[model samples]
Target chain A: MHSSESSEVEVKDVKNAGMPRRELLRYFFAPKAIAVIGASATPGKIGYQILYNLKRRFKGDLFPVNPKQEEILELKCYPSIVDIPEEVDLAVISIPAKFVPEQVRLCGEKGVKAVIVIASGFGETGEEGKKLEEEMLRYALYYNLRIIGPNCHGIYNPRTGVDTPFIPERRMAKPEPGNLVLVSQSGAFLGALGDWVSQERIGVSNLIGIGNKVDVDETDLIDWFKDEEETGIIALYLESVKRGKEFIRVCRETSKKKPIIIFKAGRTESGARAATSHTGSIAGVDAIYDAAFKQSGVIRAESLEHMFDVIRAFQRQPLPKGDRVAIVSNGGGFGVVCADAIELNGLKVARFTEETYEYLRNRFPPHYGITNPIDLTGDGDKDDFKDAMEAVLKDENVDAVILGIIWQGVVLEDEVVEVLAKVVKKYDKPVLGSSPGGEFSSMMSEKFNRLGIPHYPIPERAIKALSAMVSYVRRREEFFRDEE
Target chain B: MSRILTEYEASKLLSEYRIPMIGGSLVNSVEEVARTASAIGYPVVMKVMSPDILHKSDAGCVKVGISDEKEAERAYEELLENARRYKADAKIQGILIQKMAEKGTETIIGVVKDEQFGHVLMFGLGGIFVEVLRDVSFRVTPINRRDALEMINEVKASKILYGARGRSASDVNSIVETLLKLSELVEEHPEIVELDINPFVVYEEGKGGIGLDALIRIE
Candidate 1:
């Protein structure tokens, strides 16, 4: 099984001798002309919604292919891909599973570089579907054509306007273009995540849902995105890895340059059974996955929410030089909670240097706590937070800072948001914010997000995110040191 | 299905990779047991080597603290009798006699073939720490010195190896060397599906360690 699988990849390597894999992937993400096969005119259909989403942002030439329709979404429609006048770089197949292989063969004949198979039945259903997927793969490999999925939501690149997910904008909010690239094996997760990240204002460059993964998988994406100028972090939701050794090798190399966070599902026995049925993937031993991720410098998030929490930090803040964190909060109880969290997460609460101690001592009253996790008292205002933040961030011992800002405090003005934002940007150290409350606290959290600091709902989440960053930095350093 | 290699064969294979083991000799006769026991010095250990008996200690086929030739002969007879009672039709290979390893901090170094990741090396404190608490750390094999050190430090009970209380620090460097050697061994021999060096006796600093007992399973 292993030899045959590698031979297929080698055949593709021979076919595209000069062009690298990353360069070839551009045909999928940045195609100049895209033909949507099985384009529909009716509302609420998969074909129509795919074209609908693409028509909103895709600036390239769009051709809708259908046997019966003359036009779709006011765009000129073609009866077949071969009849299209212009050269097609990508084709999106949205027909049923039984017809997907023939369509893929037609795509190969038309010399389309890549095709996204957005149907659901192939490989995931049972033996018959698996046979259909095998036939589709044969057609793709014959012409050196790359396929994304036999059952997937397809790719979305906000910058290039090449959105292919079938979910319409009315149902799912599109995220703005930024540095994070998310890839998942489950398409529904990508649809729901689009809404979640948009609500939280987390900017993403690309969101790819690779189902069945007959051709493209997480390892290929990681290799491509490692050199992608727009991407600084690569996040994945994987049920199983197709090529475990190759995945580890690529991740180990890419993680030295960019942070890769993964949330591997199927940790328990029943969960593994569910994952196997859901994607037809064998979720091998979870403990081995843990070791491989650590050995490769990949941060494994504990949950789906934790995945984004770590991504938010990686997207906005710089990597801390060490695991020493300093906490500054107005609420004494919140500061104490953060101190415990920092230690529990394998991070040390930084000891402030004597100079920093004297600096805060001269600024605040004796009633205020002025050590690590410095409490500014309930009456502490914006100036007190400003002084505390600046003094700790500038100290050489502190690598990062977590601000436990309580919006419910009486004297703490809203202007403290702007004040703390300015202080955080001036230093190279990472600064995370946590504000736990209802409507007002969320509004303040958004303000902090806009200013380039990730704010969690509670202090524990912030500390956990910060701990992940520290671990990534430490592992990356060790990997490079071993090479030297 | 997998078959377990006799302890003598397993030790020979391990020694070929330069992994330290308490050297032993396999003898078929009772007089040969006494000769080999005296050659290796007193306070030796003797065990019945057989393909059918995987767990020698549990089968009562193992005897320790044989300080004299008379005791060695008696223990050898008892080991053979116990082996027959454990499995009447067991095809006994021979008896193994070696010098008893000096007690130190008990540690375990092992390897198991993962279906996806191939061979993975494991390290942990021995006995209750591994059985009850499952305090162990793992690394995919073909690991380096850095990975070996990390595996040792990752276990929660590693402090015992670092000289907790009044005990002297064990020679962790020796354990690291053993882990690295085992990694290479598995890489060279993929047929080895599972391995265990339980209670690998670790001595004081620079004094090295000994594989007190080992088991290897292969397809």
Candidate 2:
């Protein structure tokens, strides 16, 4: 048994070795060939899913290991990794909880560099299961073996044809990957989010769910994400942290180089207790978490909906100038509500500069709150919403704009959205909207998304998106946006 | 002197420094409890002044609003009997007869010495809010005037002190000055690990704040 003193020394050595950016990211995103241990001919099992998904999503070689079945998905199967007669980059284990230890030991002896154990009921179960997990970790640590998760849903990457198969429809994006990497602790939520991304047709470089991390955790993943050339943003959804101080330290260092957005769930007492039961984490005082988030340049996501909305906006829109917002509305109350929500979030409601007003004076009725949220006086046409947005985006003083369309009582929904989308695509500025108008809202939302802008249901949510952009721009100015 | 300071004796320590506190006097025996209650004026309070007792109400050592000398004497006897029964070996430091102080807006101020940074002072809403709401703020001791103002503003319910609910505003500067003085007191006495002045009622603009009840613990 290795002493903890030597373990600390090994950690220090790894810390100082200056691992290359591409190599670390490759460990997560682009492993060359993978072997599926416990691969089954039986459909709907985890092992079958692993083998089938790898065949469907990846171009790399996939070897399925099953003792009884000579073949799976028409590919020849080896009973164990040692019998493969070739070098393997990764071994993914999906055997039953009782057989995981032996499979991992066999993989280690095969000299595979990395492993992803897609088995549950390890540490998350009672004491007996925990003892087994400790043994697995001891094996990994002593042999310098890297493990993703003993209880995770596994990872997804488009660049290396290494899709983990949870996302439906292989072509989620145009296959043009960008610099956004998602690291979540909830496999259930991660699965749902991956579906959302596919449906929304958003491109992601890497999406990982590190459940109950007995080995690699958020900080470890973040340290790798910071150095990766293709990753510009790191989105995190954590139920709790393994080390709050260490996590904050890494985030503070990394967020200075790339935008870091985090969503936490254990704020309330009962919620905190439930989180502990699920993750075996002691969620300490909420204030400390608050201080930690603020100290690190982490944008706090209020809800799952906001998580997707904020990341999508950051990816497409230009950095907002400041918090100053302009609201264009077809109703007085919609304009009023959006104004209050915008001010409440610490963003200034932009007063139109003289040049912007002089340009738009002949464009609409004088009753509009043109200094603010330009109210189009209820009878304004689709051309008015378009013209007002164009003027606002071009003003150069306004950081972002939130437009409110009240509905059929005012103008045709399609016509207004068409005009708005044209202006948004032209300006290349951050523009958000909120409409409570039935099916019309959905149509408008689709167009807003099509134009590469974000739209929501309520005024408050739009303001929150704008606030995130303002923070991102400021962090970027500090040249500490996201550091490796 | 007793091992634990009586209400009057403790008041003397605060008094010597001109710390604003409710006026009261000490009386040694039951007969003196009646005489002191008469001279201090009727409708006063009689409390067991045992040096060993910190929370007089819990010990059943408090009798409030005594109307006359007879009532004061009887109430003082009841208090002595209860304290003796509860803490039998305790030294009876006599009764304290004080005029019933007028009620006003309540607040709590305290100083607790922390291991990392020496004494830290706290200010916030008192009573149930301190436990359930935790509406309080803290800062390391020896604070300047600006730091004192910041501490007061840090609490969520500080709007009440700044005149919420259509009420008259308390003299905020006086409260800030008192906090500065507290920071100084804690600095001068490192042995005082815990000191609390609960329900420190302050009157309208002219009347200033008063330390109605004080509990100080020292190493």
* Most accurate candidate by DockQ: 1
Give the poorly placed runs of model 2, Cα more than 4 Å off.
A1-25, A165-179, A271-288, A367-369, A407-419, A425-428, A471-484, B1-129, B136-154, B158-219
Candidate 1: regions farther than 4 A off: A1-22, A270-284
Per-residue lDDT for B40-148 in model 1, tens only? Answer: 9999999999989877888999998889999999998899999999999999999999888888988888887766677778888888888677788888878899999
Query: Which candidate tops lDDT?
Result: 1
Local accuracy of candidate 1 as per-residue lDDT tens digits, A123-228: 8899999999888887766656778997898899999988888886778998999888999899999898878888777888899999999988888899989988
Error of 2 at A37 (Å): 1.2
Cα displacement (angstroms), candidate 2, residue A268, comes to 3.4
State the fraction of real interface contacts model 2 keeps: 0.00
Tell me the RMSD of model 2 versus the true structure: 8.7
lDDT of 2 by residue, B1-219 (tens): 113345666566666666677758777777677767777888897777765887788889888878987788788778888989889998876777888777766777776554434566677776666656767776565666765786788878778877898888876665687788887877777676666666577666667888776766566
**Chain A TM per candidate, in order of listing:** 0.94, 0.87
Measured with C-alpha atoms, the lDDT of residue A243 in candidate 2 is: 53
